[model samples]
Structures are given as C-alpha cells and as structure tokens.
Target: MSLEHSGGENADSDLYRIRHSLAHVMAQAVLDMRPGSTLGFGPPIADGFYYDFVLSEALNEDDFPEIERRMRRILKQGQRFYREELGADEALARIDEMGEPYKREYAQELLSREDLDGLSFYRNGSFLDMCEGPHVDTTRDIPRDAFKLRSVAGAYWRGDSDNVMMTRIYAWAFDTREALDAHVTAFELAQERDHKKLGRELDIFHLDELVGRGLPLWLPNGAVLREELEKLAKELEFRAGYERVATPHLARADLYRKSGHLPYYADDMFPMMELREAGDDGEAVKEAYVLRPMNCPHHHSIFAARPRSYRELPLRLAEYGHVYRFEESGAVSGLLRVRGMCMNDAHIYCTEEQIRSEFKGVMQMYAEAYAAFGLSDYRVRLSRWDPEDGKRREKYVDNPEAWEYCEGIVAEVLDDMEVDYVDGPGEAAFYGPKIDILCRTVTGREEQLGTVQLDFAQPGRLGLVYVGADGAEHTPYCIHRAPLSTHERMAAFLIEHFGGAFPTWLAPVQVRVITVSDQFDEYGHAVVDRLRRRFVRAEIAARSDTVSKKIREGTTRKIPNLLIIGEREQADGTVTLRRYGIRRQQTLPLDEFEAWIAEQIASRALP
Candidate 1:
C-alpha cells in the first residue's frame, strides 16, 4: 500500500521477488480465464506490479474477482520457479510457438540491440516468460492475503503512442495484509486530498485545453497563494544576503549552448526560434532564441557582464524567474509537472575557499524555510555521478578532477553540517553533483521539492571570472539553489499538505465577516473594513442568507477565520470569531481580536 522503496533496495529485495513472481502468477491466471490473451511486459513497481496484455475480450473491474480467484488457486499449488537459458533464436522460436507475438517481437528487438550470451526464461508451473529475474523460490512464498488487484487501464505497448494499446491490470502487493490495508487507507485519503480535485473545488487554478496542456492559469485565489510564497521567499532571501534580479523569459540559444544545456538537455527544451535582421553592413544576420528552461544561464551572463573582485565573492543573485520546459503531454499532471513554472532560483558565485560556508548557508536557509512551512518529513540526498558508469563522460562533465573537487566540497560541507543524506549515484546533474530535498507526500510517494547543485565547470565555460586577492582573474564556483522549488510544485505540495485549509497568513481570504441578519449588515461592513485596513484579506458576507449558511459557506471555502456580527456584537465593540478546524467559538473585543489575528499572521502560525 504505502511502500517506500529506494532505487537500490527495491531492485533485489525479497519483496520485489514476491511481487515479480506474483506478476507471472497473475498472467497465468488471466490466460487461463481468457484462453486467448497474449502477454506483453510484467514488471514489479514500487508498490506492486502490473502486466500488459492484448485481450481477446474487453475486460473491466467486474472481471477482476474471477481473475484474482484464479490467481489464488494457482498460488496454492506451490509452483516452483525454474530458470532456463537459451539462445536468442531459440527463445524467439519458443515465444512464437507460445503464440505471444508481442513477446517474440520484443525478443527480436532485444537480440538485435544488445550483445548477449543468451536469453533467460522463468517457468512457474506451466507458465513461462522471458525475464531476467530473481523471483521467489516458490508460489508459497507469496502471501495469499497480502495482494489485491487495484484497477484496469489502457497502456500503449512499449510505452510508444504509435503502438497498440494493451489492457494493464494494476495490483498492490505487500509483505503483510496489515501493510496492504494501511496503504489502501492512505491511498483513499490521498484521493480525497488530490491537488487536481482540490484545485478545482477551491478555485485555485485551472488547466484549459484551449491554452494547451501542462499550462495552468492561476485564478485569483491561486494567484494569491503564489504571491504569498514569493513574498516569503523574498524576505528569507533578502536576510540571507541574496540580491533579487529579474531575467527575461527567453534568451539567445548561444547562452544555453555555452551552459551545456543544449547538447545535454535539448530534448526537454522547446524548439529554437530563428530570427533574421539586416545588419548595418546590409548583410542579413541570423540569431536563434529559445524559452529559458532555467535561470542559471542568465545569472551567469550577469556575473560575466562586468569585472568582479574577491570582496564581492558569494555574490548571490536570486529571481522568481518564469521558465518553460517541453514536458510530454502524458508526463504532465496537475501542477506537479507542468510546461510553464515560476522557479525560486538563485546562484551564488563564491570562491573555492568560500564554497563550504556558502553552501552551508544555503542549506540553513532551506531548513529555516521548511521550518516556517512546518515541513519536517523530508530527507537530503547527495546525488553524485557514478564514475564506474560506462557512459559517465557522455552523461556528466568529462573532467574527473573537477568532479572530485566539487563533489568533495559538497560532501565535506554536508559531513561538517552532519546532515543525514543518502548517496544517489548516477543521479547528479550533467554539470555537477547536487543535494536534493525529497519530500514524502501524503500518499507515501516521494517527490523532489527542492535542490542545491554545486557547479565547478559552468563558470569557466560561461567566461565568469572575478579578480582574486592576488590581482589575477580566477573562475568562481557557482552554487545553484532553490529552497522553495517552483511556484506550481510548492503550491501543489502545500495544497495537499494542508488539505486546502491554509494557515491564516497564507489563506487567500484570511477572514470572512458574516452578518447574522439585515440588521447587522452595517456592523459587518465596518468590521470587514477595519480588518481590510490592517491588510487582513477580510471580506463581508451581507447577503440575505441565514447566519448558519454563511458560516457554512465560509467554512467550505476554507477561510481560516469567520467573524459573525449580530446586535450584541454591534452594541459592544466586540465580534464573534470562528476558526477553521476548531470547535470552540470566542467572542472578544474587536481590537483584541485584531491584535491576536495580527500576531498569528505576523508569526505565520501553522494550524
């Protein structure tokens, strides 16, 4: 249900084997039921496993009960998994004889693409599949009550849109039934707190097809969330000695080329636009431009714009820059993955000698911001390049010395800070190593919310230099940090984190003043105006509705505070206050209430 699988642990664990073996068992059961169903791929996922099939009959959830029963029956037989190795041609022949055309085709493609000694197949009972697996020794090893079929959906064969769509059966598997039940409960809760659903119900943001996919238009309320987050980031950055700067949304293609993003990250970028203009010599000059995928290049250009001295070391430049990425349509989901985003990005140009303190300062800022947001369930990951990887040169900067130097600096700082972090080999950026802040969502899925990367190559490549105390120019190490990530991702996290009931300071409407009746309308307006003057984001609900209805509406809208004004409240200089998710209601003097709410807002109190 809520299984947390690290990349390394999940690959070879016994749980993985159970899930893998279960996939084959499920496949056999499906084939037994349908009689003519052909299989594609069946691989274990984080929580469970799924198999793709070209079914002769259309299948739905209604048919799952029978399929699951058959799976249990097969599991009770205690079938032993036997592994066999055969030549590629023999494997293809066997697959063809089994009448699995997709498997035969995949085997052929693999044989052509890879240099292999032979192909391996695993046979459990009468079911045979082409898989390189370390499956459970026997069907008895899989818990009978710990797995269940979850849902059915269409998935393209081989994940290619041009290929035929196959029916995919998803299932959940765990070591124990209790784990499965816990995961199911968490999953149900996650569905209720889904950001996409809350975003619509709360009127925060909208994704319109006319505007294109993965591009969200923030409604008024959603814009308020974004602005509040920006305000918070600016305040923190200012105190941290970060200078705010504005960068254009698009820059010349040459800028990205110099930053090494073009050759390495071109696929994720929009196509370049070429422009031609007449030069002073009457010759046509051609230039290419692209939407900025990141703010680092622009910041680098700023650092290179003028000569710098060591006194200006750690020249921190920050921006809430708008960036665009060419995310695939299928990959984009709600605000978590989008084509357009506003990044809380910054670059610190510091000398090699100052890299430790500068990097530590960024981490401190991240900790402080997380504390303010009440985010404690997160882990730091030290992502590094795998020197042993065969294509390390192609995947990372091809300078081992620079890689060692920068990675050592990062590791030393993290060690000195005594931060607990996991090593993520082969997860580094193309240019350098990075520290990723991975936050676990309510559903138990891990999401990367923030990152800080150390770059030793980009500055030299971009011609960024500062005069050293020795009076000679030297390259400054560039530290790229984004504690709050992007506006979209952060808002999505917060939406689910708080279940749309944001704290007072972050709520779009902090308070709603509702009149008990027409007689209290004037008083409600006065209270709202007073609150508004204090910048409390207060509004008045003076419609001819009942007091209960108005309060219910305000509660449903997730207003953190609701003020009810009646004859008594108007007669005295007092107001009745209702707080979201709180049962008690208190009536206090208007001035006293204002002071308390102001303190809450000022402190950014979390509920």
Candidate 2:
C-alpha cells in the first residue's frame, strides 16, 4: 500500500522501469484473455504495479493463472518496444480505431491542454499504450519467473468513490526470484503483526458500522491503555514546565482563516456547522462553526488572550485535545486512521533567541518518551520549504526571509544535539518548517510518530506579540510539538511493535491469578484483591477448566504475569508465577511476588 520508495532511492531505478513495463504487458494479456475489457491508468508502485480495467465478466484470483500464462506467451514472443509521437488529434483517432473509448477520452483531454505539444505512445506486439518512454528494449528483458499477478480488488476510477468502480489487478515484479521470495516472507510477517487483527483478538478496540465508518469505539481495556499513555505524557510535560489547558472541540470558522488553515484544510475537515439568528429586517444571519481539525489555532488565541512581556517568554501550553477529521471511507483503517483522535498537542511561545534551546528541549522530551515506551528504531526528518515557484509560492507563506531563518534555527539545534536526520523538501506545513519523527514498525512500515514545527507566520497573522527587553513590541515565534502522537495511532504502533503483548507499565491487565481447582479459588481472589489494593490491574480466572487450559487462555490474553494457586501453594502461602513468552516457572512468597510486580510497574519495565 505504501508507494514511497525505499533504501534512500527515487522511483527511476531499473526495478521501477521493469515494473512499469510489466503493467503494459499485463494490460495486453488481460485484453487478450477477456477481449472486451477496457483499460484505465496503470502505474508502477513501490512494491510492484497495478492496473485498472472494466471487464464484461467479473474477474477474481482464480483468473490470475490463465492471465499470467497469456502474459508469459507474450513475453516469449520477444516483441520489441517502439515509441511514437503524434499530435493529440491523431492520437485520439488511433485510440478510436482501437475501440478504446476510455483511452480516447484521455487523449482528448490531453489535446485540450494548450501547453502540451504532443502525446507519446509505446507499442509492443499488437498493443499500443499512451505513456512516457522508459521501457525495456524487448520482451525478453522481462524475467519469466520474476513477475507474478497478486490479487484483484474493486477500486474507483481514480480513487474517488463517487466515480465508476473498476476491477484493479495487482502484480509484483522483482529483479530475481530470491528477492521476490524475501519480500513475500516479509509481507506475511507484516500480516501476522497487523494491528487490526490483534486489536480484535486482544479485545483492545472495535469498529461498528452502526456507529459510522472510521469511528472506533474503545472498549474498557483499550481505554485503560489510552489513559496510561496520557498519564505518561502529562507527567513528562509537567516536568518540562508546560502548562495544561483545555480547548473546545468546535470553533468559529473565522478562527481557521486567521490561522491560514481554512481553504487549505477544508476538504480534510468535517463539514461546517451553521447557526442562524433573526435580524431586525426579518432576515436571518448565519454563523459557521467547524469541528476542530487541529489545536494550533485555538492555542494561538490563548497566547493572544492578554498582553505578554519579555519576562514571560517561552510560555508553553499543553493539552490532550480531541480532534475530528473527515477522512474518506476508503482511507480509514482500524486504529491507525480514524475519524476521532486525541492529540498529545502543545505549543510554545518563545523569543527568536530562545528557539534553539526550546527546540532542543522538545527533542529531549521525545527521547524520554520513546525510552519509556521502549521504542528505539526511529528517524528524524527535517522538512524544509520548496522553491517558491508560481504555484508553490501560493502553497507556502510569502516570507522568504522568515522561512530561511526558521529553517536555519532548526538545523542548528539538530546539529547541536547530534541527531541523525534527513531533509524532506516540500513536506513542511503551510506556515512553517517541521521536524517529523518517523518510526519503523516491526512490519517494515515507517510511521510518522510525532512532529515539532517552528512557525514564524501564524503569530504575526494572529497579532501575537510581546514587549522586548528594550520596551518595544516584537512578534514571538511559535514552536508546536507533540512527542506522543494521537492515541489511536500510537496504540496501533505499539500493538504491532509488541505483537499485542504490551509492557508491564502499559498492559491493561498486568496480572491474572488462576485457580487450579475449586478448592483453591479462595486463594486466587485473595491475590487479586491484594494486587488491586496496590493499584495493579489484576483479575482472577476461577473457571472450572483444566490448569493447562486456563494457562493457555491467560497466555492468549497476553498478561505479563500469571499466578497459579494450587493445593501446595495454598498450604505454603505462596504462588507460582508464569511469565509471558518465557518457559520457566518460579515459585515465590505471595508478598514477595506482589512487591516485585509493583516494582516492575513503578519502574515501567520492558518485561
């Protein structure tokens, strides 16, 4: 699903060229197998390539083998690729002769463009495709065994659900069979660590159509995990001198316009809420309010609530604000992409001279947070501004000096801290440059875990100022950071990172006391009560099942520690402890075991 290239390489490599050519060959084979099929766009992706087509008969995975065989035959024919350039009018005529209505429409659109000179077409065998020329010389360049048809799914014409749906055929191509096999193994491992499946199996979260698409209802266990993460964030922010503040979930529309997010982020934001009031002339005036898509605008207002002085420089306001975004139905996954999320958001108002130290402090906060969660594999991205071309200038604020100054400050701070990072141009926010933390999941997926943005535009636009030491008013720079990301995304990342087996500090139920038989049930309750008294999440499983069965059930829940109470343990006033993912069992006194578990939770151990 990720189309981003890997290994610090661009999309123009030889593998990319091979994949692109394979897509055209696959389309040709599909047309030969199903004669009346119509083709849409086919692009080379990160792993492989996929093509969209409309067929007279429904196609499924069962049809892949036959289609692949036909593709092999075409490959064996050793057809040479030839490129042809033609005027748009001539290209449309050729497409019409081939009876490809969709291709004809595409060619006509390109012809309507005044800037374009002509169209480029590639031909191999009896098939011709409109494309840029970067294909292999002949069909023999494709390895017969290096390509495979993956699967079939329904996709909209251009990813818009309102458009006509087409059957999309996915395929994988690689330089060699060994590389393909390794990728296959990695993909299978990723499937095993998929958070959606683990969320259900672990009773962490669920999505119901009755509630609505992309809205997830957190079960009790999941809520506990969310709260634990929030608690950790609050503790860190508090120690770093951040003041906690609350904000409304809905705000007036003009607020976003002032922050410069209205027209830019409108599509991703939920629809506006309009309220009407009667006027004196019998006319109604409407005021629009939108669900908060971000917390920065509101924080800006808070900074401008009163006049600030130089003594109050570096004012940090923090919040665990809940935000709503109108993600398209197709883009929403279980917890990774959802309609509602709680952001561990905060903004710092600091003098220009304090930007470096403030930014470094935020990086230190990230280090502490990742250490708490035992997250180690992550990279930093310093997202800078793109060259201000006509349209690109409109995309960013028109302050070249401010952009350069802010970018220089971030780079200096990163260099001072000796942090490893990569440059990402054109990935900054509309008003500022940002440092994005990218964490690599166990599944070989990189996720944007947190961000720290330096904004020199919003404070000026929102009229935020403070008196300098010289008794003159000056605009303050803003630093927006979230070391811990939204709870939904963080949970998904942790679930996959730990394979649904959370650490002691973050686990929903740290201890489960199991009774071996009916007679020892009393001892099991006593242990649960004692652990609960110490604020440990504990439960007693007193079901009348075999001890092995109870152990298996507890293991499935992934509880960090399991205490088994049998006749001998009851007589000895002790318990047998079984740790998850370990084969050894150690017997200890009840009080000693309780103290050890409490210490693990208090220290936030990674056990």
Candidate 3:
C-alpha cells in the first residue's frame, strides 16, 4: 500500500534527482531490448533500484555488457520526456504499439477500475513510461559513469506464488563514480568474508547432502568449536547465578496449548508426531509430540513444579536449548536461518522491584559475551507497544500497573547506568516489552542477534504463582532471554566475523606444527605431542609435501597459527610462529610458546 502520485506529492525527498532518473532510464533500456518483455513493477530501492520483468529468455553474466551499452546509447541522446494527457483508449493503444501484452492488460484493468476522465503518459523521445510524475526536466541528468548492472534473481509477482514468476534485475546507482567504485569494493570484501565459503575452505564445518538442508553436521574440528562455546556459556551462566537445566526436544501438544503457541505460531512449528498407547500403559492414552519450538514453556513448568516464596525471587534458570522450526525453503540460509538451532537461553522469575536490577544483570551478561567476541558496534533497543495502537490489550497480564511500573524500571536503569538505546514502537512481543540487541557484522549487515523479553501474562496463563511477603497469591513475571541467539546463526556469524581465523580458543586447530623438511620430523612430532599433553589443539600436516605447500594449505584454511621447525630450530629447541594472514614470524622459546598457547586456552578467547 502506497500513496498515489497524481503529479502532486512529496517527491522532493532529500536525494539527488539524478539517481532517480537513471532508474527510469534503466527500465527503458530493458524494454528496448525485448519490447515484448512483460513488466510487473519496478521501484527505487535502497541506494539504487530494481525492476521485475517476465522475460521470454533467461540471461547470464555475458548479457550485462550489451545491456549496459544499450543503456548508455539511450542516455547520450538526452531524450525529452513529453507528458501526454491521453484518453483511456489512447493509453491502451499506445501500450499495444509496444507489443507489451502485460502493460496493455494493466492499463485496461486500471481503466476498468478508476474514474479515468484522463490518463497521462511520459514519452521520452520514443520511450514512454506509465509513471506517476516527479522526474528530472530531461534525461540528461543521469550520470553515465555512476551505475552498474548488478545481479539477477527470480522473484514471484507481488511476492505471491499464485502469480507468474519474474526475473528481477538489481542495479546500483550513485551520484559520483567514487561512490559507485566504493560500493563495488565493499562487495568484493564481503565476498571474501562469506562464512559459507570460509567454512568449506577452513574445514571448520560442512553440510552433507545426506544429512539434509538446515541441519548442519559438525565435523571433528567443528565439534571442538561447539564444545568451546558451550563451555564458555556454562561458565558464564554459573557465575551469573544461573542453574543449568535440560529440556526434552519433544513435548505433548497440551504443553504448547497452555503456552498459546499452537494457535498463534503453528505454521512455524514442525509437523506433529502422533502416538498410540501401549495396552499396558496407563489410561490408554492417545498422544502427540510436537518438536519444541521454544524452551520458555518448559521453564514455566519447572516454576510451576514447585511451590515457592518471594525469597527465591529472580530465580535464574538457564539452558542451551535446542529448538526446531519449519522454515520455508526460500527462507533457509547457510547458518543465519536454519531449521534447527541452539540458543544460549535463560529465564528469570522476578518481582516488580527486581526488574531494574535483573535487566542490568542481563545487560552485563550481554556486554561480557560481546567483549569476549571482540564485537564493538552494538546497541540496545527498547521495544515497546505501538503508542498509536492505544495501550495494547492483548496477552499482557491483567496487571496494568506491573507493565507500566516495569517499563519505568527499565527506563530508569538505562538512564542510571548510561546504557545507549533507542526506543522502538510496535516491536514488543504480545506478552511484554523487550530489550533487543542489534549487532552489526564486519560486512555491514545489521542483525537483531538476541533479545531479553519481559513476560507477565504467559506465566499467569499457566497458573504460576509465588507467595508474596503479604502471604497471599501473586503471579511472577518471567524474563525470557537468548544472549548469544542460536548457535547456528552465531557460529555462522563468527565464522565470517573473524574471517575464519578464530581466536586461539575456538580455532578448531589452534596451532599447526609443520616440519621445514623431513629431517625435522622428529622435533615436529615431539612438539605436537607435548602441546597435545598440555591440552592445546595442535595437528601435524599429514601430507608428504614441501613445508611451503603445507603452509599455503594452512593459509587457505585460515588456520590461526603455524609452528615451523627447521633443522636449526629443532637443535635450538625454538619454533617460528606464523600468524594467519600475516607473514611476520616471531621466534619464541618452546616453554614461552606453550605458556602463551595455554594462557589463550585458559582465557577462553572468542569461539
């Protein structure tokens, strides 16, 4: 839904008009190549534009040069676009002259629906467009050197399956050649940092076709990285006063029914598993088990499992919960969006008074995790109910005061602690307000990696209560959090974050011991064995190739450190350390190298 531009609207946005005009020129170029090309729609996107077209023939990379040449030829002439106020029949006849059936059909459809006393067309020389107004005075404004024909992708019409598929062309246009060149340079850098490429090259992880899409099978090296992440999460949880717990992968349908998941979020949940009772089983039960899509429901059951007083308020229970969801085939991405993922999830039951301190504690936990990963660019967002929507009367607990009080509590904490954040409306979950962390990757994409949500209603729905100081019934507020998000998404992010050169603790193989020649084999083997004894991840290259070849292989794999032992180094009991992506080699005593390696492991550097 967009505002109609009847030659009068706020078209004067803060942008160079030159860029916008180029979009129309690009669309015209495509139409010229194949006049029969059925046009779906084209619109200016972020920084550039794209047009979806139903073409008779598919194209590849080789077609770009010809398209660019065609576009330049059209631009050089500086065609005059005359506005033609034509009748409905005239518009249809003009569209039919171009032999574009889709355009003719669309114009006819618009005539049938609208009270069209007159319809206008913009004819730039011979090229005409059914545009709603606001173009440059002429075609000369388009910069010749400031654009590039980017990629091609297939997109459904109006993004619906019921309509025909269209080939969408992505193009980027800038005000100057410098800006365009900078964009292309950034794209090249992003390609180098692609996690999927690094994962395969580094052998950190792999997805087997037999294992299935969205379900990644960790190799031996990848398992090491996962173990390190879990170890760090477990330690951090313990220090934060969190008790570890485990939940089953499947739960009865009744469990989700109470949590209100089946009715609202059933599409995302996996297909159910049905079961019939064994004759000897109690009650001759008929049953179904749905793969758990979340862990909050199970945590609520734990709270309801026992009676408690306010003394145990702010009970922090944590788990590395594994969840499964049925993601669309198109939505499934390498590691970012997967069917199965493990999140560093936790739940806290706190009283209204404990809200501020609990939120501060979670913030501290978030900072610690990000610090460990060497991530600097991040901000917290306060997600609240839409102010325009009137105080949302949905799943929020009956306690209106609690909701108001808790929001103030969070605001005060943010001000008191000097936490940086921006407020967002209509972004909060139905149950409560939330704090979402937006993390930016090295490649410049912003992802809402994790969040902490305050829930009062869902806990009440399950009849969870804690005796208050007044010795009466009171419902507890639950805070759901996943600081590290899912392991699948986080790991995928980290694989590219560090560019596969993981810090020592999570480097699959922290150090590789390579013999400069066959003569130094004994020393290399002994060094590897000693490092292994000290619990360092070190491996010897199994290939019987030249030492330089082995080093190149390690470089390709993005291995963090390489230890080379030559004949002189073997006799001297010294090792030359080569850091990843850098040629500078440092010579360290055997004991010092082992100590530094051990210290890195002890510190639990980024996974």
Please report, in order, the local distance difference test score of every candidate based on alpha carbons. 0.89, 0.87, 0.78
lDDT of 1: 0.89
Worst 10 residues of 1 by lDDT: 1-10
lDDT string, candidate 1, 360-465, tens digits: 9999999998888898889999999898978555888889898888889889999999999998998898889999999876666788999999988889888889
**Against the hidden reference, what TM-scores do the models get?**
0.85, 0.83, 0.83
Question: Which candidate comes out best when scored by TM-score?
Answer: 1
Q: Candidate 2, clashing residue pairs?
A: none
The root-mean-square deviation over C-alpha atoms between each candidate and the true structure, in angstroms, is: 4.9, 4.8, 5.4
lDDT of 3 at 97: 77
Q: In model 2, state the lDDT of residue 374.
A: 84
Q: Which 10 successive residues of model 2 have the least lDDT summed?
A: 1-10
Please say which candidate is ahead in TM-score: 1 or 3: 1
Winning candidate number (lDDT): 1
User: Tens-digit lDDT track for model 2 on 521-599?
Assistant: 8888988899999999999987899999999999989998999899989999899999999989999999999889989
Clashes of each: 0, 0, 0
Error of 2 at 262 (Å): 3.4
